[model samples]
Target: MQRNASKPWLGALSALAMLSATAAAAQDKITIGLLEDVSGDIALMGAPKLNGTLLAVEEINNSGGIMGRQIEIKHLDPQMDNARYQEFARRLIKRDKVDVLIGGITSASREAIRPIVNRSDVFYFYTNQYEGGVCDASMVSTGAVPEQQFSTLIPWMVEKFGKKVYIIAADYNFGQLSAVWTRDILGKLGGEVIGEEFIPLGVSQFGQTIQNIQKAKPDWIMTLNVGAAQDSFFEQAAAAKLDIPMGSSIKIMLGFEHKRFAPPALANMHAVANWFEEVDTPAATDFKKRWRAKFPDEKYINDMGYNAYVTVYMYKMLVEAAQSTAKEDLRKVIATGEACIEAPEGRICIDPKSQHTSHHMRLISVDDKHNVSVTKDFGLIEPYWLGEVGCDLTQHDPKEQYDPNNLPKK
Candidate 1:
């Protein structure tokens, strides 16, 4: 084919258009402040989350940028320290003046930074699943709530195992609230909780706790532990040979505990989660493949990472639709919205009332080979806890977090 002289002129015009767009993007960029731990305590979970967040940012920028403005991300590692989290949050808000903020693997870290971000009127997103029932106008949670998780999990566990149960959790807001949810759900379901314990954060020795569990001898055990140190519970429980059917709503498959621990530790353990790498779906499988391709050294992409990825995309949609990063404007857009994004788990919807993502929770069983199997699929469940508690951000901003005890009984 012979090229015409006019074709050269057309190419020059296209290059000029590209240059002009680049110059425009350079002049106007959206800043996103990221707070996550790359070392210490929650690093195992935080590192993966950071990776997922960066991946989503990369995808967004590549796909014509966010509203024609390139996204600028300032990632800070708090090293799993609450004081550091507060400091970094202040820096991001006061110094960087980021338009949007996303981070905090632990509920403690989130609470530490939440007030600062909310007071500063910054759009904040927390991607990790926790105890639930956080009513705040300045935040959007992309993780599954207690109602979505335990509503399916408790019933299944009770039916599979017996009614009697033992509960163990980390001593913090997330664990405390989760314990309450467990007791409340069991009561409503006509089941009994035989025992319960709260282990301090980073407490490894579960000798007394194990003895208590064995003595109580409930039908099963449910854990809400957090951090790498808490992983010892699995090994210790297995060592004690207290092999009753065990389950966890908060952190079983998170951080790939099944893979990290030996077969005996997690084998035959049951869990209910928002997302699992073993999910057999086109979207999930493709996400795993892409994750592997990007981070060849990493072996697992758990719910935390998956949720972080979804949160970023969720923010992108809200920001583009709102066409502004101002916190109030973003909240206003979310108030009248039902945003949906096809996540690795499935399609998650952001509820207008709750400002939390509705997820498709799965009943997962781990085998001796560290393989995960989906026992039951609880199709897309909403964060009804907030709505039940009469949390309406549109009408008025409560500027507070709600717990189950404060709300009506289920």
Candidate 2:
């Protein structure tokens, strides 16, 4: 009896050793960190974006993952707070030591966390349709930039409608830089900027702004506004019976304001984006199907979601080509890698110099019943504005984001 009992103990010890070894191997798995806003003013955009990232990650993991090892994600909501963004970013870089970091809804939030990730030499992806001009080796932007958006949008709007453009934008880095770009583009179209107003982030009442627009009587309105508070602008514009045609570079698709607010409020509104929920393509159809399967209750998937999805796949491709998760190794692949990734919108190639993707943008209009229709498609446009001002990541390890000031005025 004693001999048999000792034999059982010996077998137990052997099994314990194997379990420990397996756990150690699992610890070496790649970890990706996501800092997003799920319950704040920007949550309208952030929640869908996070859902999109999760969907792509699940797809990649189900497809044998990277190097036969599983990929894990650590997600945290920053509530659209700048301080929380910095704090959470530090924890992800220093404590979690995540291989890649993704998410940043606003330009201010992005700027807050960018330095921390850059210092730690971790790969960071910011997928918001921002005010362009970011150049960093450790950073890759898959979002539509101002030049990419306005170049196609402004000319079309100017041709369809008269040239006096009224502008209303949120007051931040994105809004400020976008205002400059708007001025430049309008000037090129030989149009006049009749009036421009910058509203604070959470200012819901746009009574004064609406009154100003009425006074100015511009031919069309171009809005760079953001957040739920800014969404009220559409309702107010309708109540005031402001019949001016509208064009937007960022708001309509990212915020899904058309879905949130009813028709007539957003009727006859035109916006340009790389992707929309209604894009008729096999890839897009499949993406929507998968998204519905995972989140049956979710209503819409906008460009914000599309950006998140594309960025993750792009990172995966770069990692596979590099065959390593080390920042330096991945940077080399991204800085010089030439590969096309099929996104829901279309095939996109990352510019080795600027780290921005070339996108096929579509001009869309919202009807009185809140239906979106694609009017025109601008296929596969490069970030020529950034390229023109000497954006090159391989030349040196410069970590500064360029301003749109250097871009050509005319």
Candidate 3:
């Protein structure tokens, strides 16, 4: 009886050891949570972002995944609501137990989840061009900041258009910071900001703003409206016959939604972007072909989508480099700035201090076909353009450093 009991105990121990080894070997299957907007005003940006992220994951998995285990993505829709975003963040961290988190189409949404992310202990990657000056330890902002978006565009517009400018933006953080940056950069470039107006987000009527624009008669109309507000503003601008050469920051001609909603008068409008499908770059072409083949019905592909897709691949690269799903280890690897994505533009690298990715920003125009085409490519812009100006514009305190509301006034 004693000999039989000893054999059974040894067998149980052997089984447990095998299980432990399997678990150790399977550490490459890094789980990520995608908190994005699929159904809301910003769905145009969010839905495609999710699709892009999935495509990246699919490609990575097909290419043998990370360290032999498949990468898994758990997606959640926040519906563009702050409260919902907070809840989703909690679910992603607590229930889903994701190793990393990515997705935020708007600055408001990013702001909403910032605190939750800081407390969650999971690495968060924000992949949208936004208002600048965010330095957070827990978050990596891979999107173009104010310096990346406004710094180049402002000077370019001043040189191409005229010195006098009118600024119109949604009354939010993004809008405010964009307006401030426009004022500052244009002023430095010898341009004058003649008029600046802030409209509430989703406001349908722009007749009054147009009237103000006409009265000011600035040489160029600089805009920062997005989502429903952009639709309303452009529609009303066309209806009101406000025909000034307009240059905008966010959602000027982002995707099919903007192309469909914006009137013909808004054609040839210029905006700075990280990527456009028409650029004909090797990376862009390959991504477009694969994406089109995969989702034949999909009409438009924008930077928002491309960024999300790249994030997944970036996650894969970091995971593979670390060879484990340990969140802290992956975070350190990504934060090192050594990891890069072969994006459409070229080699995209993260700014080690700010944890923001650097990529090419193009000065693109919407043609008569409602298709966006690039006119001039501003080579890669780093994360902190204002770093020289005494601003610790790194990724240490993203929330404290970036406040769209407290933007500079003309």
Best by lDDT: 2
lDDT for each candidate structure: 0.83, 0.85, 0.76
Estimate, for each residue in 1-410, the C-alpha lDDT of model 3 and write its tens digit: 78768699787888999989977654646778888888988786677788898888898889887777787888988888888888988998887778888987778888888889888778888988788776666777777777777877778878888899998888888788788888778878888899998877777777788899999998888878777655677767777777777787665435544456644756657888887566687767887999998877665787788788887777777777877666577766765668787776788887666667887888887764567677788888887653443334233343455433342222
Is 1 or 3 the stronger prediction by lDDT? Answer: 1
Q: Which runs in model 1 stand beyond 4 Å of their true positions? A: 1-27, 408-410
lDDT of 2 by residue, 66-131 (tens): 777688999989999999999999998888778899998999999999888878878899887888
The top-ranked prediction according to TM-score is 2
Worst 10 residues of 3 by lDDT: 401-410
**TM-score for every candidate vs. truth?**
0.91, 0.92, 0.87
Candidates 2 and 3, the one with greater TM-score:
2
lDDT of 1 by residue, 304-396 (tens): 888888888888888787887777777767777657777777777788787888888888988777778988888888888788778876765
